[model samples]
Target: MHRFVVIGGGAGGLELATRLGDAFGARRRNPQATVTLIDRNPTHIWKPLLHEVAAGSMDPYTHQLEYAAQAYWHGFEFQQGELTGIDRAAHTVTIAAVDDDTGREMLPSRSIRYDTLIIAIGSTTHFFNVPGADAHAFALDTVAEAERFRRRLIAACTRAESNDDALRAQGALPTHKRHRVQIAIVGGGATGVELSAELRNTAQVLSAYGLHGLDPRDDIGIVLIESGPRLLPALPERVSTETARLLEARAIDVRLGERVTEVAEHAVRTASGRDIPVDLTVWAAGIKAPRVLSTLDGLTVNGLGQLNVRPTLQTELDDDIFALGDCAACVWPTTGRNVPPRAQAAHQQAEFLFRAMRDRLSGRPLRAFEYRDLGSLVSLGHVTAVGNLMGGLIGGTMFIDGLFARIMYMSLYRMHIAALHGIPRMLLDTLAHWLRRRTVPRVKLH
Candidate 1:
């Protein structure tokens, strides 16, 4: 039987492995292939929702999908380890030993031979080499980072409230003096914009829960600093304008055309010498593929460290090795540029690869992958969203906003779930979450 090894249990990788296993794993009487998925984390969460996780709007525990459970249900194998190296000539990949929280070894290092290898480890936040940025600012690239920010947010609010109360009791609380928590978000992309909106709601929920004494609207300040002229530069300008208007209407401080030069312990300094005092800083400026991609046995990579791939999604240097998602630099013939690194693009690549792999097994000719632009959506809190829908069916781009747009934004996640577990399970999962929402706080408190 052919052995297929996939590194990374991200959205695209996990979905592809599940499909391959279902079609060719041991469960089938005449199994043709064995699928194995490796990931550093035991569970998987959608990358786009990391902002919600950071803002405490989403409880990650309730939504995380355990890889072991997924593998058991889908006829695939799960390996918990980080990719250390890949040997192209030997047709094997080395996995580093994994250690528990207490520094005890959980799994020893091992090598897995594969007839075909797929790399989809995803991307990480790029800080643009700003001084003190990497050391002080937080990046929402993983669950742990998001959770850390959430905890710090709760602590900051609590500390500010306590300080205000102490000042009041000591008769030192002046009428004009108000304790505040200021958050500085660097970037105006989807992650930054979405996070800013979510943070606003989080502040209100925190106040409603009696977790803080400061006024949510006035005492909690969210400053969004963008080097570009507008927010969501990748989206239509109309969407950007509307998104800016929505955020500004919520009292968020949207600073445009100002590049951050440095990040200090308590503030962010801009090129204009403006210092924005902050209790916390989040870096969502940009993204680059993992550094490991460059060291992968002489695989050709672009300046951003993304593995260069042909239109077929096969690496330029090797046919047995493939890459997808944020890690691959696959060209878009329509735009003459690499496909934008988005969840939609990743989903499309996974679907294409599934069909391509099947064709290869049957000795049939493989088709080139073509990416379709379905437009984009930017979520503004829980009640509103701004974006445009594009397609031949729409005859052009149609702008949408308000509650309808928010629903459409949410449906993207639902569609991802359906891809992995089918429509019935996705529907059941949605119903279960809806019921659970009524019994719990809208935002996570702890």
Candidate 2:
């Protein structure tokens, strides 16, 4: 029997493992392949939702997938470990041991051999070596990190409200002079834009709960700083312009073409030597493949540490090894551009690899990967959404907004759920989520 091991239980990796297990690992009597999935974390959550989680607009636990349970249900073996290194000559991967809460070793370091190896170990936040960025700015890269940011946001709001109460008691000024809480987000990408909007809604929700003394609309300030001339540089120019308009209408301070030179303890310093004081700072500027990729035992990688893969998504030097998602640097031949690291791109790659791996097992040729631009959507909490749809009925890209675009934006995540848990489970999960929201606070308090 062929042994297949996939490292990383991210969006692309988890979906690939699920499909492969359903087909080959489901039947024990005549199994075509022994599928195993390895991940550092015990659970999986969609990476894009990290922004919502950070803003406390969404509870992550409801959407998290337990790797052990998912693996059992889908007929795949789950191994909890992190990749230490890969031995291309030996066709094996080294998994480092995991420690328990008390720092005791729970799992011993081991090596797993594979006939077919797929490396979908996703990317990490790239700080660009900006001074003080790594220390002062909060990054939403994992569940723990997002939760930490949410806590800080809650604390900042509470502190500001208390300060306002003290000022009022001393008759410093009228209620019109509201206490202000400032947040500085560095980046104009979807994560930064969406997070800013979500944070605004979060402040409103807190005010409604009597957690803050000042009016949310007047006192909560969000400043988005982008080095580029516009936000959402990857999307259409119109989308960026309209997004900027909407954000400004909500009173968000949008600073463009202002590069952040450094991040201080309580502020963001821009290129013009302007020190914008902020109570909370978040960095969502850029991404690069995990540092482990660069030391992958001679695997050629780009400057960003992404593995150089062929059109077939296979590593340059190894035919049996494949990669995708944020870690693999695959080119879009049509546009002569590296495929953008978007959820849609990851979904497309996973779908292609699903067929490609099956073909490999059956002694057939694998086809090349193609990145389809299904357009992009930036969701402004629940007020509205903006994006374009590719190859619409009008024969070209059709720009859309409002309710229609919101539905389209949501369907992207639903599609990912379907790929992992099937349509029936995905629908049930969605319904449950909707019902749960009605009974809980709009935003997490603690």
Best by TM-score: 1
Instruction: Give a tens-digit lDDT track for model 2, residues 298-382.
Output: 8899989999999999999999999999999999998898999998888889889989989999999989998888789989887
Q: Model 1, stretches more than 4 Å misplaced?
A: 175-179
RMSD to true structure for each model, in Å: 1.1, 1.7
Of the candidates shown, which would achieve the greatest lDDT relative to the real structure?
Answer: 1
User: Residue-wise lDDT of candidate 1 within 271-364, one digit each (tens)?
Assistant: 9999888999999999999888899897999989999998889999899899999999999999899999999999999999999889878889
Cα displacement (angstroms), candidate 2, residue 60, comes to 0.6
TM-score of each: 0.98, 0.97
Candidate 2: lDDT of 301?
96
